[model samples]
Target: MTMIVRDFRPADAEAVAAARRSAFPYLVTTAETVTWEVAGAPAERQYRLLVAEVDGQVVGSSEIGVFHESEEPGLAFANTSVRTDTLGRGVGSALVTAAEEWLAGLGAAKIFAWTVEAPHAVTFAERRGYRRGRSSRVQRLDLTTAALPPLDPHGLPDGVELRTAADFLNDPRPLYEADVECTEDEPDDVPAGRLPYDQWITLTWEHPSLDRELTTVAVVDGTVAAYSVAHTDGRGSYWSGMTGTLRAFRGRGLAKLAKNDALHRARAAGCREAFTGNDGDNQPMLAINKWFGYEPAVTEWRYVRELAA
Candidate 1:
């Protein structure tokens, strides 16, 4: 029963992705995304992807890194997932130990992680000195049979227009600006700061999973008012990475408008299922998701551990 934990290699992408999907099926994971994450991380973040092997077979994986873009310093994260068939073999514990050591060596003051809300999963973290915190729910919509809201582009407000991300291929600064505003206001445990345009371009705008044609934006007076970021695994499944409205556009129902349009586009593009995650306390977004016929698929509990300074 020899178990080993080591840094991820490009050749291990498929196996690592498979382990992740086994733990969280609602997520959009692929070999390309796995490889991109390790290669595209910002140097300041000190990111690393670790894989756990048992008897020469990859059975678990985790990503650990500093929260460089967060307003709060010394914050870091480690998310570990083990293949269900190999869970009791110490694979998870090995990965967690390796990740925590790596982050601590990098001078992180705290580490945040999450697990599906199950008794065994909860106990695993608690035993490792992690305390439970907030929870988020992953919702799923059956795109094949959902009663989606009809989109009437002509019926929009006088200054409003519906457009896709592809419409801004020449210059996406407007979308990036709107995203910065929308993201800052979202409820989260980590206080995320705006990413530089160049980092955003490489890490987000050009992500392998992002589907520009399926992402919808609400334009008001030539400016992006709201938008729905769409990501797909190219396997008939779509994920709403984010759906938000700018401060001035909150009450205008623009977020819903953008999200609905994105969903429609995703379905029309042959996707059969849609998924999204919302913080437990984000009632406004939760309500909107419910309106879209998204039902709770699973709840994930956040956990945190403090390291000695």
Candidate 2:
């Protein structure tokens, strides 16, 4: 079967989401979330979605764009996912070629991609001049079967209170501030700069997938100290968007407190499974997830390639 790679269309949202889910079962994506992501992307991101077709059927998908939030300029990304059953048909290669050409046209100096830890996946990336970088583990928890630790509001440190993200709807600047502080310390192969408040408000706070009511925030003395952002598909799957505590509040167990509250709320809301990811070196966050009975499900490695100017 001949393979063709082209820009994604609105009608392909479902197929794209399906392909993504097939490639990464731990993710929670729907047609609506995919559509919203493609349409609501900021101009700076220059986000573009591509799909690979065989006999008119979408067998692979890719998300290509510049790392607009990175502190370094000319950093780009092209994450390609081909249905497991459709692998080795040149679909992934075609998609990567198209994505690289498009990003090179945009003057990207370097491009990054992620691939599963399997040998075939790593070989595909290396053959295309992509070098392996950092690795991250995808974790899953059986919310229905896992023995979740109980939440004790009174046991929290004095002056610390757990609140939902919805509590700051009228004024979310504090949450934004906390997010900025925590993200600065996150482990990543590419450095992510501080996210501007305006952009955060539009891309994160107003995003369709973010479940504000389930997101837990730890407030200390009326100040946001740590938070656990939650995203749900309105079904039974819950994903952790971000869970972090301010530098000053790191050792106080506030991050765990916030995530525990968030996960408990998610389970109480009928969520059956929970998913999260962390860099291999992010031991603190990994330990926290382990405490919640999350088991490592899959692993992915970052790959990078330099683009000719």
Q: Write the per-residue lDDT of candidate 2 for residues 107-179, one digit (tens) a residue.
A: 9999999989998898899999999899999999999998888878458889999999999999999999888
Q: What TM value does model 1 have?
A: 0.97
Q: Write the per-residue lDDT of candidate 1 for residues 72-95, one digit (tens) a residue.
A: 999999999999888777888889
- Model 1: how large is the Cα RMSD against the reference? 1.2
Regions of model 1 farther than 4 Å from truth: none
Looking at candidate 2, the ten consecutive residues that score lowest on lDDT are: 148-157
Give me the candidate number with maximum TM-score: 1
Question: How close to the true structure is residue 278 of candidate 1, measured as C-alpha lDDT?
Answer: 95
Q: Candidate 2: lDDT of 70?
A: 89
* lDDT score for candidate 2 against the true structure: 0.91
Give the TM-score comparing model 2 with the true structure, all chains together: 0.96
Q: After superposition, how far is residue 132 of candidate 1 from its true place, in Å?
A: 1.3
Model 2 bad stretches (over 4 Å): 153-155
